[model samples]
Target: MNFDRKYLVWALGYLVAGMCVGLYMAASKNHAQRVAHAHILLVGFAVSFIYGIIHRLWLDRPGKVLATTQFVLHQAAAIVMCVGLLLLYGGVLSEPVLAPVLGAASLGVLLAALLMIWLVRQSGRAEAAA
Candidate 1:
């Protein structure tokens, strides 16, 4: 699909997966996936949806390089963070790799967020100047 829709699809997928995880936890009475559930719902679903909204609202902005970078970073961060958190919560990742993966994912997410903020602020300034 289009640019914004891609992120929205990812968000929706995450929401569905999160719901399944929640249901499984409820049925099995095992709370170990609590962290994974939270991350998928919040970071994956909510944050990605927000990014999609931003993309939709600012569709006409120039500087495709920045926009593309932000989009890639956001998607990558969401995927990496979700997977890393899932591995950590499931006790699959070892001590050494766990921290690094999580840290890098967190940094990627932070950078993408900051980039989005910058883009929005820049657009606001441009509109004001116009």
Candidate 2:
């Protein structure tokens, strides 16, 4: 499948997951998972959807290894971050126990952003060269 379509499909999954969390919070009146829920929507759904658009509209090399890596990294990191936040806020785990996981996930998110910037720059150059 094309990266754009794959990303868009996964984005809908994230949207559902995020919405489930939101509905749970609303019903329970427990906003403890608010941070996790927000991250799931923003990073998992919104960012992935935007990335899909970028790949579809801007990139000619959507199948490039770096693009695959960026997508995988972003999804994995976002999931980890969301899970860690949920564990922390739900009092299932201590901050110290999940600190490393959160930190690495945060760095992974930033790295995905950097990869996206590079990909966009490369796409611009490719257009110019063509």
Candidate 3:
């Protein structure tokens, strides 16, 4: 299967898992439990899956080195962000430390989104030129 299709499936699976987490959180009244569920659903599954799909659909190799660099940055950001969120929610990480990690991940995701936009624009331009 193509990368895009694989990503789509991954995204859908994350969505489903997020929904289940949401339901579980709703059923529980504990604050920590609710926060943990939120972190897993929102940061761990939703954000990472969306970013992965966007990257699979949009990233192009101008050079092997650059492409590899981007992939590493993206994956690293996702992993760090997810771990930071989990730690924060579990009360193992302080806000001062977690904020920067989460911020970096947000920036990484934003960069990927921008790359997707650029790729779409480039395709449109190429089609127009043709």
| Candidate number of the best lDDT | 2
Candidate achieving higher TM-score, 1 or 3: 1
Rank by lDDT, descending? 2, 1, 3
lDDT of 3 by residue, 1-130 (tens): 5434444555566567556656765677445545545655565566557655654655432234544454455556655665676678768979998898789887886675565456556656765676
Q: Judging by lDDT, tell me the better candidate of 2 and 3.
A: 2
Better of 1 and 3 by lDDT: 1
lDDT of 1 by residue, 1-130 (tens): 6667888998999999899989998999988889889988998899989888877887557368898898789878878888887788778986588888888988998998899899888888888888
The residue pairs found clashing in candidate 1 are none
lDDT of each: 0.85, 0.91, 0.59
lDDT of 1 at 43: 86
- Name the best candidate (by TM-score): 2
Over the stretch 1-130, how does candidate 2's per-residue lDDT look in tens digits? 8888988998999999999999999999999999999999998999989988998999878447898899899989988998899899889999999999999999999999899989999889888988
Model 2: lowest-lDDT 10 consecutive positions: 59-68
Cα error, residue 75 of model 2, in Å, equals: 0.8
